[model samples]
Target: MTRDKNKKKPPAVQQEKLNPRELNTEENKHSNHPLLDTASAEIKKYLHDLIEEFKDVLLIQVRQDIKKLIKEMTSPAQENTDGRTEEIRKEREASEEEFKHNLEYMKQIQREYQETQNSIEYWQNALTETKDNLLKLEERFRAYERERKSLLKITRNQKEAILKLEDDKKIHNLRIKNVSEEAGTSKNEIQKIFTEILKQNFPRIAKRNDIQIKEAYRTPATYNQNRSTPRHIIIEIPEIHQKNRILKAARERMQVTYNGKSIKITADLSTQTLKSRREWGEIFQVLKEKNMQPKFIYPSKLSLKINEEIRYFQDKEELWEFVATNPTLQRALKDITEKERKRYQDYSYSGREASVNGADHGMRE
Candidate 1:
């Protein structure tokens, strides 16, 4: 291979002008292009350097473009991250404000609950006190009721005893009505007049001593010259039988004269006994009309003859009970029974009201 070192190459052929990239081909090397085979060493070295410099310049340009593209892509992501951070800060502030508001509302609710509890406790205590007071009042009312009933029983018994005493005092007394009252008339003169009148009517030869007059006087009243009515003469006898005899004799005679005037003689009775007797008037008249032979048995009792037997009634209530057993009597006395029932109810109601008022007065005392 060294033997042809100085040998002459083929003649250079005239070709189209080409760049180094076109000249550096496998076809040119295989074809033994005259410029490639016989080119000067300096020329080859210059072409190699030019190609290496071009590659270097291209690599630098590529690196600059890639860096610019990456910067462009990452700038928008960074801006988005900053915007998201600002939104997170605003959301945190809003959540904190809502929490504060809820806390304030919860505190207010707690305060209201405490106030309600206090009110409930106060009402409970008041209710307890009210219940205690009511119980006390009930007990006091019951005690007053018992005391009132006991007082009513005692009062009724005392009144009955007083009435009995009054009636007993008048047992031997008589009243003569329509007797002329003369001024300056003495008790002895009145007694003598009564004796004369009794003797003239009875014809028993009763002397002044036989009459047994204990005392005699006109009813106490102021004497007036212009007064037309005369006061009655009240006489007290020593014995009850003597008084009864005079009453019987007076009843037997239709008219008794004293100083040419007819007078009425009746038994002197207590005011209470007289009132009770008057209350029996209507019943007495009805019984007499029916031929029941009813007679007053002193102090408001009645003796009735029925079925040939004698029956006694102590009060209208007892008579009502007996009449209820007899349909005919009940029918006949229906209106009277109703009237009496209404009267009794009114009396009972008034009595209760009086008792209550008296009890209240006693309590105050």
Candidate 2:
């Protein structure tokens, strides 16, 4: 029993023993652990604060730099602004100058147009006036032509009348010449016969006046035998009373003298007596009794003749008057007059010699 009790007691008192080196190693590890942990946490907290402060500082510096750059870029420059303003002013001035030039040019063109218009109007008015004058001149020319035609007609009539008058004068002269030739009478003898015829036909003149009769005798015996007779007869009668008597005697004589001759006689009424029908009829009957036929030439024919003569004479007178007024014509006329005088003197001398020779021959015979 004792032994088992002792063993149990011993076993209750026994313990485990550690190594020194291992104990030291484990103590060191434990001792360094608190230091490492504290160091890591301190380092972490320090890094967080440093990062926050650096972020704040960086943001503030960036904002300041951006503001400075903007100020530099956006600021106005005085010199450049002034230059731009001056350039704008110059452009405005140039525009105004161009407008003024254009206005002046337009005004010049308008003035030229107005002047041209005025010239055209003046020319038109002148042309119108000239046309009017020309028309008036044409009218005047037409009037002149009408007047000329009238004058020409008058001239033609006058010429025909003048020719008829000349023919009548020629016929009368021819009749006188023929009668003188046929009678074989001297001018004085014929005149005496005419006077006797007037006295015989004019009873009123024969009764009113005393006529002395004379005759030509070949011998003194014949003269003594016809002592009461005169060689010529003179009847003292007025010309007015003798005219009608002379015409009657001439008609009676013509009937006796031209018994077998183809003789035609005509009596015309005087224009003054034409209105007196009784006087005209009496004259007509007287002419018919003397075997004379009366013919009436148109009054207009006679008037035309007179007018023609007048016109012809007027033209001749105009020419003669002009010539007479000229000194050259006057000298020419004087020369002609002198020449005519010389010719007349020569003819008179020749005629006197011929007359003297004829008288000598008559005395010898």
Candidate 3:
């Protein structure tokens, strides 16, 4: 390793210079390659010959391309291919200029088309947004209408229920007929008269001190006028047991006289209910004749035991139809029809005939 490190170096020999002529003398304006002159000269000669061989062919092809471009730009025309050499050259030059002008025109047309397309897109987007909004509004309006209809139905049902409850309260009231109304008589006067009538007719009930009168009033004079008129008064009793006893006794006895007048006691009903019962007058008579004991049940239902099976009627027409089919009902109905006809005739002769035009609805409760 010490011998290697101390090794003396010999003097280096110089490289011989080359003659430029031996390198095949040639040079370009850039003067890049020296030894590559021969290959470059051959490449240049080959390219020159290739160009010379295809010069007319290239020029003809270019001229045809320019003429074709012009033909595409303009309307259909006759071609003048067989022309003088000078005329063809001049036509080609004019064609080139026209092609340049058409290219510029096409570029301008492309820009205008792009602008039109952008405007159309903007309006389309706005119209789509508006359509969506309108659809949403329509949906909301339909929902609101549905909700309104639902609310109206609920409100109508609630009103009917309230009216039914009001009518039900009339069940506790009692009406006294042929109880004369005195002139300038107030509630106290009417009560005194009512108490005396009750005491005379229903003795056992009147003696009970526990039975309290909630209200007492004289009937409206118009209702008890003209057809063997009975002056009426209304009484409200709170005790169900006492009221039932009085009502039951009155129904059984069928007649009560007070102050030399034939007084009758009856249940006080709502106007609608009384009208409904009055319509069943003939039906009630039929039921009575048949010993059916048809009664006004809760909510104004007509109930009776038919062949041991309890049947109910809400409509008079249904009762009439049922009677039409049953022999017993048919016979009973005939009697009532004859009675109505006879009553109608008597009224025709009397000239002061009383006809029920509307329902009598006044009650104490």
Q: What is the per-residue lDDT of model 1 for residues 41-86, given as tens digits with 9 covering 90 to 100?
A: 5456656765675676678888899888888988898899899999
TM-score for candidate 1, residues paired by index: 0.50
Per-residue error at 230 for model 3, in Å? Answer: 6.5
Candidate 3 lDDT, tens digit per residue, 279-341? Answer: 677777678778887887754668876667677876554465476687765665676666665
In model 1, which regions exceed 4 Å deviation?
1-157, 205-209, 224-228, 307-309, 314-318, 321-328, 331-341, 348-365
Q: lDDT tens digits, residues 170-240, model 2?
A: 22210121122233244465455444443544455456654332321111122243445322212222342
Report the number of backbone clashes for model 1: 0
Residue 298 accuracy (lDDT) in model 1? 56
Clashes of each: 0, 7, 0
C-alpha lDDT values of all predictions: 0.75, 0.45, 0.66
> Least accurate stretch of 10 residues (summed lDDT) in model 1?
1-10
Highest lDDT: give the candidate number: 1
TM-score of every candidate: 0.50, 0.29, 0.43
